[model samples]
Target: MTDTVLVTYGTTNGSTAQIAEAVADILRKDGLTVESRPARSVTGVAPYGAVVVGGALYAGRWHKDARRFVRRHRVELAERPVWFFSSGPLDASAAERDIPPVRGVQRTMVRLDVREHVTFGGRLEEGAKGRMAGMILRSGKGGDFRDFGAIEAWAHRIAEALAHT
Candidate 1:
């Protein structure tokens, strides 16, 4: 029987949600029963055979709900296969390539023994149009720098790892 997988994500400007959906799709194709839900919507982790948690980075912080979910479910999560992903960075500029402050949460999760964590560049959507975004965009500073090929390859790797466990 296929294992149940839960992909819970927190998104502010929408890129993280899209990335989570892509990961879920890849898991489903691998014959896992997958459900993609917003982080706030998640009630419990017990139903899932494996959990994949993801969040967006904003101003050097992860979405609050993502942090809470992990904190609340840390014990259950530690007993199972878990993976983490963060959707951040806009392009190949020095700022994007450099580690952002919001990345610290991944290290915290690693301490809890999450099996894997991956970072991927996010998108700049309409709602993300803010003073900072505008300044960045006006400066012609960033572009949609997400690497779909790499994302897919990572998803495949996650699937392969899960299959063996």
Candidate 2:
């Protein structure tokens, strides 16, 4: 509870990482200390006052690393404010509507009492790994659909909530 926030994510092609960075940057600009890192790399959550976990959606589920992170830190995370995000839906749908978290993610949210959960548009670019990604690209279904404005706005809300707390 030192007013430091940890923004961590599991990304397959790096888009989720970028979103985490954006969230961390906004928190920093709002006068809070923040760290952004990969979900699997974090050893513990003892040093953070709040946590933001994000994952890339794949085949209707959250990234495995993200799920593992939550399971590993559930005890510590339950004592602090926590937020979750999922980056998927390679369309504008995420931006146009509030996409509910996948079933597993929803379960985690309830278990952790997460402050909020968001579903952001995902990015599948030309060099994304995996045969499915290549197929999506060839089928012309890959593109960047994340809305920075919405992301910043969400981060700002987090900052505001933290300040009040």
Candidate 3:
């Protein structure tokens, strides 16, 4: 069986992509083959033994491309091990907020029997384009808040799970 794992993500300003790459790197370090791609660019999932899908969160919802990817691949994903992640939350406190998964994602999770969903802290660059994001950035709260240690720990856990599977 192919041991390749697919790490795909959706991002508006690239923070989510960075997180996805970090996860992929950790998995690769554990001796697994990893392929990383943007959600919209991924054509199929059959070649992968496991799938890790991630997206940037906005207004309590996942990026549209990521959501669409889940909807399109729910069946194949159900047949394999699947994990989901959202990259949002401006700070540690935001990361601790008890935000519920968006309805679409929740439905997809049930359909795919997803193993886990992790939400990581996000970054907001000052010159980001969106009006809402721009306004938030003006408030001087925007900066990289990603917890790399936590992200690596989660990836290691995934690697362990894959080893047993």
Q: Which is the leading candidate under lDDT?
A: 2
What's model 1's lDDT at 109? Answer: 68
* Model 2 ranges off by over 4 Å: none
Residues 1-165 of candidate 2: C-alpha lDDT, one tens digit per residue = 147899999998999999999999999999999999999999999999999999999999999999999999999999999999999999999999999999999999999999999999989989999998999999999999999999999999999999988
Deviation in Å, model 1, residue 20 alpha carbon: 0.4
Model 1 lDDT tens row, 28-112: 8887789999999898999988898898777777777788888888888888888888777777542245443355686666667
> What's the C-alpha lDDT at position 144 in model 1?
76
Q: Residues 1-165, candidate 3: write the lDDT tens digits.
A: 338999999899999999999999999999999999999999999999999999899888899989988888878989999998888888885456645566777788888899988888889987776998988898887999898988899899999999999
Whole-model alpha-carbon lDDT for candidate 2: 0.94
Q: Output the worst ten-in-a-row residue range by lDDT, candidate 2.
A: 1-10
C-alpha displacement of 71 in model 1, angstroms? 1.3
In order of appearance, the predictions have TM-scores of: 0.86, 0.98, 0.93
Q: Which pairs clash (backbone N, Cα, C closer than 3 Å) in model 3? A: none
The predicted structure with the larger TM-score, 2 or 3, is: 2
Computed on alpha carbons, the lDDT of every model, listed in order, comes to 0.78, 0.94, 0.88
Ranking of models by lDDT: 2, 3, 1
Question: Which candidate should be chosen as best, given TM-score against the real structure?
Answer: 2
Candidate 1: worst-modelled 10 consecutive residues by lDDT: 93-102
